[model samples]
Target: MSALAKQTITEQEFQGFAVTDFPASKRLKVVTLDEATIRAFNDAVSEWTVQGIEYKPFLRFEVADRLDAITNYTLGKFLNATVRDRATGAFLLNYQGSPNVEEGDARTEFEVKLSTAVSHIIGLSNHDAMYGQYYARFTVRNVDDSDSYLRKAHRRMELHNDGTYVNERTDYVLMQKLKEENMQGGDSLMLHLDDWAELDKFYKHPLAKKDIVWGAPKSKNVESKVEHPVFFEEDADGKPLMLYIDQFAEPSNKAEGKYLYEMGESLEADANFLSVPMPVGSMMVMHNHFWLHGRDKFVPHPDLCRELLRQRGHFTE
Candidate 1:
């Protein structure tokens, strides 16, 4: 059994879901909810609409509790433990099979509600200014005119941490695929900080903790700039943690520029990263500080399109 498998409860331990190691990386746990669990969740939350959950904040927590109740609260405990552990801070959650819900919008609503429960189980998501909600849903296509690489297609988005330009602490990030058509490639890219070969060389450098300006593009809906070093803080065990991105970083001098550039170059060249193919209903959540996430480019097809939902926030406990 892999290390993550050891950390996870055995299939017999949890009634609603089964936990295992994702094939691409043992550090990532794969949690699959059985069809019965999905059906129970859908029936439990059927009374609450997505709009109702959005309008009322407390309803979000209620949805989370309903999902946990089905599993006898084992799902929440396992998810929290996985996220809190430095060695295994990420998981890919998908259900066993289709539920009884109709396809199209009904299925999409189920996806949204499911993601909301998962997020709340871990922590509350920060309000996404771009979408004016706690979560944001965006799409990518073959051709686009976007301010940033987020919506752009045909090129690999360099690996980087999220919420680098925002003031709030981003303890975790949740990404879910809502729709896809004629999509080839575009697998989710991930790299654990501990896996980076050059982590120490950069962490011990003088510029590692020096504050640097970070500003987002107009499309991000963030106007003000924030300042923080690549290695901004340390975990409970004193291991280095990071908050950085290649695009939003604005170094003031040659020294800062070179440091930022080398960091990005080193991360991009690292061989320890994992490339994960995300299924439509599956959601991937990771520790934002320790695991860098990105997207691989899609094949150029005029009809290509993919819709994704995202939630970034700090842990309450």
Candidate 2:
């Protein structure tokens, strides 16, 4: 059995889902919910509309509890443990069958709620300034004019950590795929800090602990900049906690610039990163600090479009 499999209660079989190691990396657990769990969850939450859940903040946790209850609460416990463990701090959640809802707005609403339940299971999602909600839904197309690489489809998004510019401590990031169209080559990319071959080479460097400026573009709705080093803090066991992005860092001098440059170059060149293809209604939640994530560029197609939902926030426990 894998290390992550050892931590889970239901390895071979569970109440509503089954757990397995991702093919690319053992650090990521793949949780596939049975069809019954999907139908039962839909029926349970049918009484509450997406609008109603949004109006009542606490209803989100109620939805989370309802789903967990269907699985005998084992799913929640396993997911919490998986994310908190540095040895395995991520999971890919996808269902086996379709629910009662049809495609379009109804389907999107169902997915939003599904992601919400998953998000609250481990942590509460922060209000997204860009989308003006607890969860943000955005689309990517062949042609793009976005200020950041988030919506661009032609080029690869370099590996980096989230919450670099935000004041809040973003402990987790949840990314879900809502829709896809003519999309050929857009897969989610991930890498653990310990897996990076040059981690120690950069961690011991002087600039690794020096404060660097980080700022987002106007599209992100974050006007203020924050200051922090690449290795901002450490875990209880003294492991490094990182917050960085190649596009957002602002170095004032040559030394700072070179340090940031080499770090980005090393991360991009690392061969240990995992490239995951996210199917519709599938979501991946990861510990934001130790795990670096990005997206592989999509194949050029005029009609290509992919809708995605994102929720990033700190862990509750």
Candidate 3:
């Protein structure tokens, strides 16, 4: 059990947010901020535009502090505690009512700023190689000629962790839906390591700790191949920490190949995985090692377009 499992707090502690279990998964905490709280946050940070926040990194923390201050600092403490707890290291944060922002570019810019503030409250986001920025915003259109499975709309992206091929410490991953049009059947998929039925079968395997080569495709813009074990390390309690991705891993031999192949198959077939539907302006944040995330296939349409914002980074003490 995680430390959070034993910790208790009164309901009155959180002023304008309601905490509840997600429909399909009890482990995930759904935090919905009230309209008043959202308005207060937006109003407090209205002066710091996205450009200003980007230019001054310290200002990002100020933005986070302002948002947290609205809840008397209870929201930040609760969020950090929930994310650090192994038993429940994930949360879906969405406001009860929409902010007073215009549609189109203006709304998208506000979404980016809001996500940035939330991320800074927990930790600093790593520079995204794909976008050359602290956060990445990309769209999934009806036609995609991308090299990897990321932008492909017709097939599932597969269960995997982020920062597999990169050297950065990706402690957490935040994915927010910005816009969607003519979309269906593209729910986010998540599988907790502890909930995976076959975790022990693979974790105890010989190749679990063996170094495997990983390389990204052209679109990723990462030229070199990095090496790491599937079970990269253990947590403070000595539990396994996984870092595996099906697409980028380059198994050198038949044994390694077989091991990875079986692991992927096991993950896909696991019944404990959660299929989460993210509405516009909602974001899902999870511990990178303990949680494996993916995307379901999208319904085909000539004008299908879904814009998403992503940030992967390490936690700050």
lDDT of 3 by residue, 115-163 (tens): 9878988899998989888898899998999989989999998999999
Ten contiguous residues minimizing lDDT sum, candidate 3? 1-10
Candidate 1: clashing pairs of residues: none
Q: lDDT of each prediction vs. the true structure?
A: 0.92, 0.92, 0.90
Error of 2 at 104 (Å): 1.1
Q: For candidate 1, write residues 97-195 as lDDT tens digits.
A: 787899899999999999999999999999998898999999999999999999989999999999999888899999999999999999999999999
Q: In order, what is each prediction's RMSD in angstroms?
A: 2.5, 2.2, 1.6
> TM-score of the candidate numbered 2?
0.96
| lDDT for each residue of candidate 2 in 128-245, tens digit (9 for 90 to 100) | 8889888888999998889999999989999999989889889999999999999999899999999999999999999999999999999999899999999999987899999999
> Candidate 2's error at 112, in angstroms?
0.5
